[model samples]
Target: MKLLFLLFLVINGAHAATHSLKYFYTATSGIPNFPEFVTVGLVDGLPISYYDSKIRRETPRQDWMAETEGPEYWDQQTQVSIGSEQTFKANIDIGKQRFNQSGGVHTVQWMYGCEWDEETGATDGYDQDGYDGEDFISLDLKNLRYIAPVQQAVITKHKWDQNRAQLENRKHYLTQECIDWLKKYVDYGKSTLKRTVLPSVSLLQKSPSSPVTCHATGFYPRSVMVFWRRDGDQVYEDVEHGEVLHNEDGTFQNSVHLTVKPEDLDSGRYECVVQLSGVQEDFVTKLERSVVKTNHGNTGRTNPGAEGSGSSGLIIGAVVAVLLLVAIVCGVVIWKKKKNAKKGFAPANTSDDGSNSSNNTAPKA
Candidate 1:
């Protein structure tokens, strides 16, 4: 009986502490057609470990690989993600079909980010789908779910009520996996002096925007602090802080934004400071206005191959659409040719239809 109780505690202990589990499943339309990706983030109240579907590798991988039980999840997660990828693609299509009989115009996506905090109980960082600048089939973790075409019977309330349990269970399962992964990593990191990935800070300014951003990336263990200082004292107000996001190679990045008036750019002095856990040293970068290209006009655009938001680049069936378009054009050409045949006129090697092709018999003049 004691052993059984202890086992229960072993499984349930993670929930009793301050932590978060966020599972992101996304499928978006794009070229090169790499659709469908699922990633899980484990936060022991601060970003700690991550599981990316594309690589099937978990961040803080060294500690995970050290565990005998940990390596098993590598193959297990890969297989599970592979299966979810198809389901997510279908999920994306469901939203696209809602707005468009064929599909949406640009890109379409279905995404879910489930994060549970000690204070908030459970919340979705983001739970929605975007189709051609419109959102549909939205689901919030706290029971505030509504579709865009809600009034028009897009999805009956009956079906949605039934599927609620299933969706919640899926979120729960991923959250449990996160708890296990984070607990193991925290333990592993403490067992030894873990090798550190030093922080790199950059002073940048966005295009067409007056905000100056201080970006810090490529650091490990995830217990990083990034802040802006103005000549010694901490500058609090007017500062925009971004979430800590994982890099492709398992490091973390964050950005702190500050807006400066055009005239005040030269007068105010600013610096970016980065501090990583387990490292006695800190990295500080001086903000240089001349070095940052604020007027370059394309700074806000994201890199396609970069670490964040890879979910927005998944592929949809462009080939089928292209084939359909070509078939329509061909049908139009054939119809015109048949009509010309009835008129006792057909021309080979015709370059611009000209007036001759329309009326080959001299226009009855």
Candidate 2:
């Protein structure tokens, strides 16, 4: 019984103190062999559901979600995504007209989410829209108004702000309905969501002159802090932090780089520290020459390919990285054809129609 109690604590004790549920809706034009409209729902940075115009059906991405939800739930979500698809398609067209563009490659994205702080019982929500990788409009829940960053979106801001019913519905959905759903999801995936996994830390060096990199991978919950310390004090100068990237197994990885003189590197004063949320212990690695993993050879040079193979790059798939959302959306705009489009825009050779007009649904009241 005592061992059973401890086992329960190990499995269910360390949940994410703060949890978030986010939905990303992306609509693109002039992209070849890609979904024109795509929607992804994430809970605590893990993908829960995915929908694309090609599939036309909402599918569960998480095992817990798949086991917990019935066909009716998926069907309802599919219908909602279909409605959102039409809305986003029209929105992108309107945005193009507002920008005074005839035809080109463009993108419109909507990111909305709710965050819950478990300890404090506090909840927050946000709804933001971006066009061409720039902020267009965002909701100010405090004032119940929409803020337009660019002049092209001022019309949309004014129109959305004035509709009191729309404002109320959005607020209620984000704060109340969204929170309810988020809680249900947490409960459904408690076993997996509550478990904590520590990261495997490594110190990698390409060459003697190159900066030393401290890499941490295979961690869970996605909230981790990694930094360099010199003689037990945190080092800020000459340290560069990399973005947290998703591993293929749903774990996360990140790296921090530190540049120091060869003498300083040999002094053994620097150490790397990793702090994972919900875990009390700090994983530390001392900067010792023998302990550092290096590809340096007799000529004090490292193989570029061998060194680069261990580095994390942009992960592409249905499970989107929070930090790489903009990069993924903007970087894929490779020109298949070029026309007399604007300087920043890519030319389009394909029709932009993604859905039938008859199936298009009006925005919810």
Give me the candidate number with maximum lDDT. Answer: 2
| Model 2 worst lDDT window (10 residues) | 336-345
Q: Which stretches of candidate 1 lie over 4 Å from their true place?
A: 1-19, 29-79, 101-135, 138-157, 163-249, 255-365
Runs of candidate 2 with Cα error greater than 4 angstroms are: 1-15, 297-365
Task: For each of the candidates, give the backbone clash count.
Answer: 0, 0
Candidate 2, overall lDDT? 0.68
Can you write out model 1's per-residue Cα lDDT over 244-280, one digit (the tens) per residue?
Answer: 5545455556667877666545655776677676577
Clashing pairs in 2: none
How does residue 148 of candidate 1 score in lDDT? 45
| Local distance difference test values of all predictions, in order | 0.44, 0.68
**Location of the lowest summed lDDT over 10 successive residues in candidate 1:** 337-346
Best by TM-score: 2
Cα error of candidate 1 at position 118, Å: 9.1
**Please, what are the lDDT tens digits per residue for candidate 2 over residues 126-208?**
87778776777888988899888799988776666666765676777677777878888888888877777787776787888
